[model samples]
Target: MLDWLRVVRMADMEAVRWALVGMSLDTVERAPVGVRAAQLWVSRMLQVGLIDRARPAFRQGSVVWPKDTTSGRVPDLFRQTARHDLAVSAVSARYLARGYEWRRDRRPITRRDHQADGVAILGGQAELVEVELTPKTPIRYKAIHSNHGERLTREGYTRVVYLATPGACRLAMKEADRWLFRDVRPRVVAAPVMDARGAWSGEPDAPWAENLMPPAPPDDAGTPALWEGIA
Candidate 1:
């Protein structure tokens, strides 16, 4: 839990629960104790000062941080990016449950000027994962994709992935389909969170492919691929 918190840094109580749920993902029984246990353990940790939460915890989008492990300026980004970052954590939680080796540095800046959300490695393929809760300008997309494209050419990455929410998902896919470069095209899929303090709605339904993009995996678990020749 500390490792996930340190990597993700500042997540709300519910997002933390989702991460715990991912760790509790069982191939045999699929125990949901992660949800139940999250509250208990977190409260206990607060009492013992192993962790901390936004005061009066019932406030809208109350978040928590690893006070024991945190340093520098305290969680200032919590207010601005809580919704987006928690949504990203939801996506990461799903990946964790699916057995992907997903990770990012505590600072989360993959490149000097370009920071993707996280990267997933599985089956010897490295996927640069981006969570798009809102759309960016087209020109911004052009520049970002250009940089991401360069990564495909030189970096060890196999492909890029845009895990967008409902509205943003379609735009991400449209942009990918319109991309001229097939080698660097990204796989855009739906990854919606169920409102504030809610769970990820698109859990366990993976690699949602359209028109010959490989069938969706069974409900148990599945891996999302990086962009191939899927243009």
Candidate 2:
């Protein structure tokens, strides 16, 4: 079951934003139940560190490029990127709490091609992260990601993370990383959070598999004696 679910994956960014977009659409359509459900799902994912708010640009860096350095559509691209970044940020924060040090929103090596979402460099760890908004088929997608895993490997980033929506090309990207860098993370996460409706409408039949609830507490007499001496 774990293997099966692993195959049915979602990037944290796309999962969170997809919920947001669905809720937004429901709200715009005046679907009250859908709106409430969407809100709940979004809230749940956020609370669990599956999604986070994007950081503001320019902690204090100078405006290195002209205002219009990128095409007009660039802002839109940034918006898309930011959504994914938020989810990745949430994941990074969780890892940080667990003693992993990471830097978010890293500046690009070049000002001309700076990315709004930015990459994360795990402290003293050979890992590089890049979040993707568009499907992998786009030319920009290729330009940004092509040989990235190999380059990162050469540069000592042992693993590269490519978070994106589910698609054939996206899957291929993961495979490509295997052939090129030999250090990419094995799994491309699919983080599809259930909407409120989706959550309520379904049965909790697979509780242990999902780890949705804590294991039942021990009896008042204390835990079973089966392992008492072992402890």
Largest lDDT belongs to which candidate? 1
- Across 1-231, the per-residue lDDT of candidate 2 in tens digits comes to 112112212223323323233223233211123445544654564566443333245111111111222342212224434344344443333333233334444456763343323333334543444444444544544445444544453555433444333342344354454453222323212222222111111122333213211111211122322112221
lDDT of 2: 0.34
Which pairs of residues have clashing backbones in candidate 2? Answer: 9-190, 10-189, 10-190, 10-191, 37-196
Instruction: For model 2, state the Cα shift of residue 101 in Å.
Output: 1.6
Residue 166, candidate 2: how far off, in angstroms? 2.7
Error of 1 at 91 (Å): 1.5
Candidate 2: where is the Cα deviation over 4 Å? 1-82, 110-123, 168-231
Instruction: Evaluate all candidate structures by whole-model CA lDDT and list the values in order.
Output: 0.57, 0.34
